[model samples]
Target: MRGIGYSLLAAVGAWAFWPTLRDLAEKWQHDPQYSHGLLVPFFVAYLIHRKREDLKQISAVPSWPLSLLFLSTALGCRATSAIFDFLPLDGLALILVLAGAVSLIQGKEMLKTVAPALGFLLFALPLPYSMERWLSQDLQHLATLASTYLLQAIGQPAINEGNVILIDEIKLGIVEACSGLRMLMTFAAFATGITLLIDRSWATKTVLILSAIPIALIVNVLRISATGLAYVLLREAPERQNMLGFIHDFNGWMMMPVALVLFGIELKVLQWLLVEPEKLERVISFPIRREMPEVPARKAA
Candidate 1:
């Protein structure tokens, strides 16, 4: 009976927000920068699944007041969207309705338990155009400045003007697309997911999350530096163009993997720094029998 009611609530939600979902889907499909939005729903589902054991321990009690509150908020947002023709409001209303459905079925305790994952869903929503543009411009300049200095440090003649890096005769422009904003967003989201899954202290989790910024900057620096080197070495226009194109695409795709590796290193460094020397030695000596516990003589002997 509960399952039936949940299904009916889900059906109603689908009917109410189909247009919003469709619009969001179109954005996810058409916007390359926001393509990662497609995976956020799956990530949310996975997080909830990971908490199933905790969820099973509680009995769901419906809260009429909470449900009504959420429903009213959703209706208000829908009305606002209709008045302003602002589609993002409709999407916001859909999210509110989802919260209301949980309240209707599983109550406020379950909502609290699931709120972090639900909050994460906001990352799936695209930022306002003005904000995105400002961030992208800042990132582009930072990348160009870092790449120019790094290239010159290695004895390459490089100059940066705005977001373009000139190494010898080749000019590499760090456009908005290559501004590393994508990597920053994707890796920050990835870090949040990883931090949730790990059984670590809040401080450690904070470190892991904060480390994404430096990791992203370092990775972007390396990517641009490599581009500079490739341009200098590949003097032929055809060869340089081919190599630059490959480098751009390859580095763009590999940022996430590089972020994972860097985050793992940060965790290891944190452990090494915080743990005692004996514990660290034991970890280093694992499987070598050096730290094995001594056994007492047998009673019969």
Candidate 2:
């Protein structure tokens, strides 16, 4: 009965937020980097199978007691949003509560473990115009500094604007849309989801999530460098008209795969280092010899 009440409430909440979610997705499709940033989520599903053994241990009829925590949290967030006037924080909280409650009542450990994917799904939805611009501007500043160092490493003369990377002969400006922060958000979401799904240890999950920030930074740097290289090479040739576009799309596709592979290696290393099978209990208590009744001497046998 408790679960049924939560479900009906969630259904109402979801219906209320459906239009907002649709609009966000519709806008996200317009940005290629964000569109490609979605690949990590698609890859996350591939890793879920790795935990099937442990998942089998989880019960089918979840403990409904767990739902109370999420429902309260979700309601609190929504109430806060209604009073304070914010977009989507309430929606996100509501989703978390609903999903978590359902998982408690129905899903085994495998499904319940993936609360982070809900975050990733939220990232796919579009941000408001003001928030998007603010983030884009900040990320552009970060990308500019990163790319400048990269250009210097390769003996290229470069200059930086607020978000532009100027090569000797051409400019690589961060358009309002190509801000790499979205990729960072996307991967943070992905890392959270995947680690929770396959990783049994809390420590491994922690490392996996912490690693995403640096990984995002590295990938963003590499992307910026690749663009600069393409521009420099193209300027030298002055003939391959469409080559830069190819570089743009190809780099976007490749960076994500490499990051995923590197994360897998990290997971393996963590597993090897941290996990130890439980050994027979060495410190288990035993009765004091004097306190125990002695067996009748073997004479009876």
Candidate 3:
């Protein structure tokens, strides 16, 4: 009976969300910014798998009221997405539908247990076009500013002209493509996944997640600075354009590793600074005996 019910739910969900899923898959393939979306589903599945034991402990007592609410909201989102041609809404609707299904079939405890996995699905969805464009432009400007400062700090004659940096008479444009938004989004998602999987205090998790933004930005700035330095130092090298292009692409590929290294350092720092409550309690509860000097016995004699 449970198998039949699950089969029916899966069929209905697949049929209803086919369009949304198709669009998401295409974006993951074609959109560089959201290419990380390709890995998110697998990560979500892994998260659910990790929670299977905890899930087994919870008895299924379907919550009709909450399930109805979730399903109703999902239906409304789907309708709105269809009416307005909004893809994000479709993604939200899909998540809501999943939540509703879990609530209906496995109960609210199961829903709560799997909520993080469901929420993680949002990382796979693309931002709205307007928001993405605005953010890209802002990040481009910031990157230009930071990279120019870095070049100047290292004794290069650098000037920031809006989104372009002029150093040693070479123009490096911080185009939207170079804005580092992709790194930021990808790192943010990576951090969130790590935070979910790790058993850490909420403070540590929060710090880890928040640190993604600055780490991504810093790595991107370093990349831009290195490119500028390479251009200035090798201005007269033969096939200079080809070399610079290769450097640019290589730096882009290396950004994630650099960010990961920075994140690792952050985790170490957090570990050093933030003591767990249980450990703190043990330390406090441990007895510290102070032995009196043996001179007291001589004095008594």
Candidate 4:
């Protein structure tokens, strides 16, 4: 009976959210910045699987009030999205509906157990247009500034002018596409997923997630810098244009692996710096023996 209820709920959810899911899939396919969205569902499934035992231990106690509240909000959001033609709102409605379904069927304890996986779904949704544009511009400017400085440091006659870098007579435009926002978003999602899966202290998990930002930024900067170097080095070759194009695309593909290596290094550093509290407690509890007082006097007596 419980399984039948879940199946019916799943059917209703899928039927209602079909359009939203289609739109999300389209965005993931068309937008480079959100390509990582494609992997999010699989990761979420894995997370749920990891928590399956915990979830099984939690007994269902449906909450009528909470379920109604969430479902009503979801319906409102869905209607708003239809009126405004906003996809993000639709995505939000989907999340809320899922939450409502869980509350209705399995209750709060089950929701808490699966909250991280549910929250991870947000990464699959695209940001609002205004926010995405603003982020792109800022990232472009930062990448240009950092890349220019790096080029100068390496003895290249590079000058930053807005989002474009001038190297001698050549121009390297740090356009929206080269802004590194894609890498940042993808890496952040990856880090968060890893943090949720790993058995680590909360502090360690926090640091791991936060560290993704700087690591992503640094990797992006290196990629831009390398591209600039390649441009300079291949300036006079007959195959310069082709070589430059290849290098640019190749560096773009390499960012993730480079970021992963940096992430590993960070994990190692965190391990050295932040000993788990449980481990620390064990160390503190470890018995220490003091040297026994000399028995020479007793022997003499």
Candidate 5:
């Protein structure tokens, strides 16, 4: 009965989260690049289950003032979203959801324990519509330039028009969808999840997450470059423009695999670049302890 009261109160207090969840739906409907949006609730459920053991161990501390602060910030974000709609990154929404969940389950300390993992999950959210448009243009152009240069590098005749690359009379428009940003987003999302799962320090996670972005872009460029080679070297006539159509028709499915391969490369590179945290701690703390004067041991209270 006592447990029931606590659980019921938590449910009632978590009501403030409805707005954020609705906002997520609104965003998902707008410019969805993948079907992963449908999986978000499941993902959240999985995270909760994954941490179920830890949650059982944690004793929640209710702080009304801190919770109200978080609530106000969420409201402020919703209001800011009303006017500008680009006030926060999609990740911030996940943070808000986690905040409410933590308020219901525990508090700052327990929340912090899994903050990196939750923050990493936020990568699954799509980019804001405004930013996505800008990125799409840049990626399209990059794909075009890379494709043209590669064709010419192999001594093939090539002409570039904006994002449209013409080779051996076959034209390939590195269309909006083909810009590879979609693949990049998908790969980066998973990479973030993996990084958080393994690495603990914020610095290491941040570096890995940031690295995911550029690595995705480069892998995308490579995919485009490969497709361009096939179009130019294989096609014998100008009428064979279905190069892209054939490759992406259901070959769009191939992209997930390609992106995953790229993500693996990123994981390897990061693992090599990173020294283990235990080693780092030893390096930093060893000198400090040796240099500082030791205090006498204190009696237990």
Candidate 6:
């Protein structure tokens, strides 16, 4: 009966916040950079499910005080949103409301049990417009500079101004879409989810998450450099004007897989360096064999 009651409260919370969630869904559907948003919820759900047995062991004592605090925070968000016209605040309020509902129904234990999953949901929410633009512009500039340097290193005549790279008089622009921010966001979330699932040390998890930054930057650099080289190769082919467009789309799609491969390599290196040799031996070593000693020589003597 108590479980049913908690479910009802959760249902009520979701129903009340349906409009906000619907709006977020629409944003995720329309935004390419946030396309990964659609996958985040499923991952959160999976994480919660993985913790089911652990959660079941905790008592659901009603946490009225925490519930009140969370409710007030949600209300505050709504009030702030009304005055500031910030849509992200509305999404934040929903998160708080969900947290409050969990606290109210199942108490602190349940809330804590699901906290990481709730935190993961933050990745699905779109960032503030201004912040997203600022970050994107920074990534675009970095990608341009890195690509130009790489091109020059390879003996390709390349010059960059702002986000545009001029190679052999072929101009390649690193637009907002090519900023690699999307890769960073997606891979960061991916790495987080992976760490949560794996039984690894905090240090390993931290390194894994931090590695996403360089991995993303390097992949974006290679992508941009590839585009520059592609332009130089195909510049004379007037009939293949659409070739660059195809290359652009292909590289955009390839970024995630390349990031994943790099991350896998990082994981392997970490395992090699940090994982105990005894564990590896247990996993891969053949059953211990009794080595026949030359002690028989002593008896002969």
Question: What ranges in model 1 sit over 4 Å off?
Answer: 85-88, 274-301
- Rank by lDDT (best first): 3, 4, 6, 1, 2, 5
Of the pair 5 and 6, which is ahead by TM-score? 6
Clashes of 6: 0
Error at 73, model 5, angstroms: 1.0
Error of 5 at 193 (Å): 0.3
lDDT of 2 by residue, 171-289 (tens): 78876555677677777777877765663667778888889877877787788788778888777575556788888888887778878987888888987887623321333444455
Predicted structure 4: lDDT: 0.91
Q: Quote each prediction's TM-score.
A: 0.85, 0.66, 0.95, 0.96, 0.73, 0.87
Candidate 6 deviation (Cα RMSD): 4.1
- How many clashing residue pairs, candidate 2? 0
lDDT of 3 by residue, 271-294 (tens): 999997888899999999999777
Best by TM-score: 4
The TM-score-based order of candidates, best leading, equals 4, 3, 6, 1, 5, 2
Pairwise TM-score winner, candidates 4 and 5: 4
Flag the better candidate by lDDT, 1 or 3.
Answer: 3
Candidate 3 deviant stretches above 4 angstroms: 292-301
- Residue 276's lDDT within candidate 5 is 75
Identify the superior model by lDDT, candidate 1 or candidate 5. 1
Residue-pair clashes per candidate: 0, 0, 0, 0, 0, 0
* Weakest 10 consecutive residues of candidate 5 by summed lDDT: 85-94
1-301, model 6: which lDDT tens digit per residue? 9779868876987787787788889988998878888998898899999999999899879899999999999999988977887778988898888898889878998999899999888888888999999999999898889899999999898999888888766788788888999888888888888888888777789999898888989998988888788888888888666998899779877888998899889989998788655576777876767888766545655
Ten contiguous residues with the weakest lDDT in model 2: 276-285
